[model samples]
Target: MSRPESGAPTTTPPPTPPGESPAAPLPAAGPGPGAVAVPPSPCLSKVELRVSCRALLDRDALSKSDPCVMLLMQSRGQWVEVERTEVIKRNLHPVFSKVFTIDYYFEEVQKLRFEVFDINSSSVPCGPREDDFLGAAECTLGQIVSHKKITKPLVLKHGKHAGKSTITIIAEELSGNNNYVELFFSARKLDDKDLFSKSDPFLEIHKLDDDDTFQLVHRSEVIKNNLNPVWAPFTISINSLCSCNYDRLIKDQPGVALWDRGASLGRDVPHADEDLASGPVDGCG
Candidate 1:
């Protein structure tokens, strides 16, 4: 290029910087130097401990007169019970539908079981042998495992100290034979999986007495797999079937106080006379 005369100025653009590519955008963020990504929290596994007259029993022939729901867990090594207190009194006009929710804190769950006992006839057989005057008892029991909703086994992760999960039991009497059921729960790792096996869980129940003292009325060990933990669910009933006799005592002593008087029952003991019947149930049907 030639320069003009005295007043003319020379003009030229500066060169582009080295290492700068005109066509390329800045590189997006990539993995940091030797940094590992953290894994996500594991999803919990759950099962609907469902029981229905339609699913388990014949409904058309069932009767409301014998409406019932009974829950039992195998605690320690014995069978302890949990029954509906209302159903015990409403033998003649029982409520048909009932449900309960149970949560699991991952551990040993002996067994979780449900029983629909018939009390219409005092002679109705109940229990495992089903040959007692208590009534007829039918039940379902099992352990917790991966279902269609949960394929990957529930994990407790390396840093997790404990795991908790809940199950909701919904029941509609529909016709008769009051529906009863429970969530039989247990836990395990994905690598070492056991299916439909039992888990042993523990529970404790304390009842307050009239003397303002707390007493242990029942102790359970492990019923089966989530079957029953001697310590957890305590079945108690105060029926008025023979209260007329106790009424005579109530008349003699105003404000008659009959409380739970017994030694501390442990999860290993199924039933002990120490867990005595306080007095009598004092309500009208």
Candidate 2:
């Protein structure tokens, strides 16, 4: 037997030198269960909304068959439609754009559908068909719906509304089902300084569905001061319906009636001006 010379058994090794650090254990070859790869940087999912078109360049050039874009804001469980008027100038190359204001109260809604409608100022029967006006031609318009994630903590200091933060969003087109797009956004909070106590804060949402009629999908109210809240992504499944003859829906002796009613309900179609100029022309083929 070997002689027992040591004061203590030597199985344990000596302490590591102060200058050395234990090797960082090799990263696990694969992610372990329950460890979701730190959920993809929310920024990776940002999406941007782009609205563009042909007829939008000239209001006078508008016709019943001219293509126009419609955006339906669906959020807080309500759906509101916005009609865009095309803007055109004499010298510009038919650039189109429109601005929509949100006037609903809701929370946790962040997806929308952009519907492309072919409208003929002549077809709606609200105005005289002008022979000098450009005959019905097809036009294209597009809107982008994008979002950004709060990569770093967003500190919305009580009064700071102009601070910008970057985030990522995933985007999908309302008309295209298989296409999914990603985008990044540098977003700033809306300045509510002008908002009065009675004035509701408006946030726009896009709805995706074939039905002109929309049901309340969800309902929510703003919680005054919730911190570090993470919202799970939600999607409104679209049920595509056969294109219906929407012309019959508008029945009027003069186009003014629909406009008057719309104006009363604060639901006036911004593009109603086109109807006024187009006159009461028959849309039925």
Best by TM-score: 1
Backbone atom clashes (below 3 Å) for every candidate: 47, 37
Model 1 bad stretches (over 4 Å): 1-50, 55-65, 85-96, 121-285
Per-residue lDDT of model 2, residues 200-263, tens digit only: 1211122222333221221112212122111223322221111121232233111111110111
- Would you list the C-alpha lDDT of every candidate in the order shown? 0.31, 0.28
Error of 1 at 138 (Å): 10
lDDT of 1: 0.31
TM value for model 1: 0.25
TM-score of model 2 (CA atoms): 0.22
Error of 1 at 285 (Å): 31
lDDT of 2 at 247: 36
TM-score, every prediction: 0.25, 0.22
